[model samples]
Target: MEESDTTKYVIHAHISAEGVVERPDVVGAVFGQTEGLLGADLDLRELQKTGRIGRIEVNITSKYGKSSGNILIPSSLDKVETSILAAALETIDRVGPCISKISVTKIEDVRSSKRQQIIERAKHILTAMFDETVPESQELTEAVKSAVRVEEVTFIDNLPAGPDVLDSDAIIVVEGRADVLNLLRAGIKNAIAVEGTNVPQLVAELSKKKTVTVFTDSDRGGDLILKELLQVADVDYIARPPEGKSVEDLTQKEIIKALRSKVPVEQVVEVPQRRRNKQQMQQQEAARAEQNGKHEAQQREYQREYQRPERPERERGETPRRKSLRRMEERQERREPPKEQEQQPEARKPEPREAGEFAEIMKDLAGTLSAKLLDANKNVLQKVAVRDLANVLKETNGEVKSVVFDGVITQRMLDIAAEKNLEYLVGVKMGSIVKQPANVKVITTE
Candidate 1:
């Protein structure tokens, strides 16, 4: 039997002879029986000559003049030819002049075994050599954000705060340094921590100047801190974390939602100056300039409230608050001499018919996110969406007189309206308006 290394399949067969037979007799019987059984394409002699058929091996044992053994033939032929050659091996009825019987046992795929070994070897290499230190994109982003926030956090009045705490028009007051850090991580640059339950005098003064919202955990400590701030500082609103959660534990989304859903400080805790004791009054006192600014802000706030009558339903339970605010306004008024009050000019509001027309247009445009340009006679000169209102108004010559929309009126829109010499502007709500057009009257639905 010849030997060849490029083998893909091995055929095994069992042989038994009527008389004693050796391995040579068994190998010769296999080749000779299957020689012409298949065509020239699969001839065993031709396959062996081309090295397509590997060595034929046999193992035998002779006992009591009887022989039993197994034959093995390796082939690289296609499956159809290999199976046919295997099947033909069973037709051998004699082995080299001896009556013999042969039966095919099994065929093994050499390549399949090699493939399994390759796979197990690859697994070992992967486990031992590959790098596993790479982190996910989200984790990398969080790490970079934490580093940047740590750099931007500053100290205000020796209390931890975001960089913009002193400059922003609105500020958030939290419980501790950790809460301030969390707010900084959320990209809120106007947050400052009180550091404890005792409200600092700086935060109280800031409350008198800028809008202040007290934000804290929803636990017992938070409630006590909120009460202390309400008594000592002029807080505008109160924002609480979720039940059983601390401010530092809130995610960015939860923090934003809590601030957005904040309630007015008066609604959360009503403390009428008329009802407060002398000590509480002393705690709530401020400098004369702060008092003046606070009174003017209150007057403007009440003026805006008077323009929108949506408070009629809420007036029942707010009587004490209303009286308190009224008394404060009267005291501020009496302090200002008659001459200074006369010199201060007030902006004129829209006329009843024109104001009603603007209100009607605003009501009709509700939820539409659209705007309308009106002529002097309340005629719609042009209609555009709120997003394009400023650009469209800028392009118009002077045909547009009044503007009405179902969106919040911003200061930029007001400036554009003033440039266009528009007479009146009306919107669903008014945003922070620092600069008012002296000639143009601005009205809001509420």
Candidate 2:
């Protein structure tokens, strides 16, 4: 066999004959019987000549005038061809004598077994290589340098602050302790956190001594903190993360970019004041226009109420005009009943028992941290993890009558429920949902 034909399959067969048979007879019968079975492409004669099939070996023993032995054939053919060749060997009925029987027992793929051995050897080699290597001097030096640069975190006035706050000429004020660590990682060692929305007194005092740059998140909460900081401290400059990002989450490059883009406190205060003044003017104009409309409506109402002539004193001779007005009033009274009837409210019907039952079940499930979907008859269609509730809600169609989950009811969840025309969402808490759909009722346990 050539080197390329090293990976071949081994076919094992059992052969038996009633008359005594020798090894050569068994081999000859196998070759002659399966020669034309699978056509020329897989013919055992042509395949053996081309080195695609290896030598066939036979071992036989004779006892009591009966012969039985094993037959082995190796083939470099692919799986389908190997299987066909193995099956054809079973058709050899008479091998050089009385009725013979052959059965192909197994066909083993040699390459798969070799591949497993190679994988185990490769793993061993890699592990040995890793174990033999030691850390170089340069790697040790880099490790030491990194350790030195890890600044120690300390507390100042009960707020987390970096080690270089006292020594540095300028300080960066951030929203939380994580922001302080991030800035430190970025090589800005003079960062400190106010810990919360409220500015600490020590931070205000530090602002008076050092050049303080207030770095906050780029959200509404950040703006509120900035306003409070301005009221309580003498801030020099203001920095903010990119829109929709938090200070703690900014990358080193982003942190540097934000710091470079810092604006003077004067500009920050003036722009917001201008915006506030503009908003106040718009509100005042809107209020004035509304008041004017109300005044016009009231004037029209007064005219309608007082323009009618009072009954002329009976002492004076009743004028023809007064008699005509009195008849008109009597006709108007007859037309008012239909309008009053239209204004009366219709009676309300009782709610479905299923909905009430579902609500009760949901109330009992509060704080369970699981989600359940209900059908029209209040049967639970599915129960799922609360974290997967949003995705499940998106894929479900209108068959869902209500969704009860032990999680916060967010606006996104509410919107999806509304799209499916879902009637009720009972949860443990509610998020800030600005625009609630009128068709969906949101209920919270707390």
Candidate 3:
């Protein structure tokens, strides 16, 4: 028999006989009848000789001329070959002069069973080893303490808040849930989050009862949120994270320092007012400068108009009413030889027809909320909704020479027009444009 270590499959069979049958008879019948039943590769005698099949064992009991027993065979062959060998054992019809029947009950893969046992044992070994290497008393205690502190986080009116927010005399309002958690970690148990730029009603109501400290990030968004809260909520103090930093990223020491240096709400509120006043002053100065420029332009235009030389009066004979007048005028000119027939100032040149055409087109588009693109010949290229004007212009590839829209001319529209090198832009109103290009003429209805 081969050792169990080399065996891969175990086949179990039940045997029965009508009359008494011994164990040796059953074993011999199994080997003899099943011999050559399969091919030479699966022959029981050959397989056993090559150590592919293990020894066959038979156990029996007899009672009143009837016998029943079991047969066991182990194989190193694959499952299909093992199953074929086990089936062949059922062909043993007679065991030493007694009619017998054999049936294979089960075929077990030995390695699968061993693998399950190995996995369970490995789990036990790893668990014990891990337990031995765990943190010591103080380290474990601190870990538990930190976990408890984090668990103290609660919610107030759908906003992340600490467990003691309602009971605390002072409350710290932060930007988001992460900031709230960071404050909690630092032992500040009266913190809450507005969650975003919008100030919540609960926060506003709490501010009326408790002293509120608005702690925010140091970015533009934080400043905007602070302004929003100040307008709606009764904030008492304001604390800001370090420049270019966020409340959620601040360490405990940094958080404490910022809180300690917080300014009163009145001081923070005055900062924006002072900024607005400065901006208004600058705007007033710019308005004066622009007015001066327009006044100078008007003066230059008047000077040019009046400085032109006037046309000399014609003599009597030069009058177009009669040939006699012409003859008389020529005679007088011959007599005096008027100093260089003073060149008549050229008739003031008429306004370009294209400007009139553009005006008519803009008048038609007055309340239509539509735009027209014109080519160099004053022919309409395409008309589109004012909202789609910018996109259409971008696609025109400089084909459009002018744009007339019944909408506000915004800086964005101006930028697009400049890129396309448009000649003229006409709209109902003009937006706050910080800069204007000299090449493109911008006109408004009012």
Per-residue lDDT tens digits of candidate 3, residues 293-392?
Answer: 9779656755554444542332533323344444445755777543663442221222466457667888898755579998988789888866457768
lDDT of model 3 at position 124: 91
Model 1: residues with Cα > 4 Å off, grouped in runs: 1-151, 272-446
TM-score to true structure, per model: 0.31, 0.31, 0.31
- Model 2 lDDT vs. the true structure? 0.75
How far out, in Å, is residue 249 in model 1?
A: 0.4
Task: Give the per-residue lDDT of model 2 (tens digit) for 320-398.
Answer: 4566566557755876463332332211222565346656766766544468998877789998756457778889978
Which residue runs does candidate 3 get wrong by more than 4 Å?
1-149, 271-446
Which whole-number lDDT from 0 to 100 does residue 199 have in model 3?
90
In order, the Cα lDDT scores of the candidates are 0.77, 0.75, 0.77
Query: Candidates 2 and 3: which is better by lDDT?
Result: 3
What TM-score does structure 1 among the candidates reach?
A: 0.31
89, model 1: CA deviation in Å? 84
Note the clash tally of each candidate.
0, 0, 3
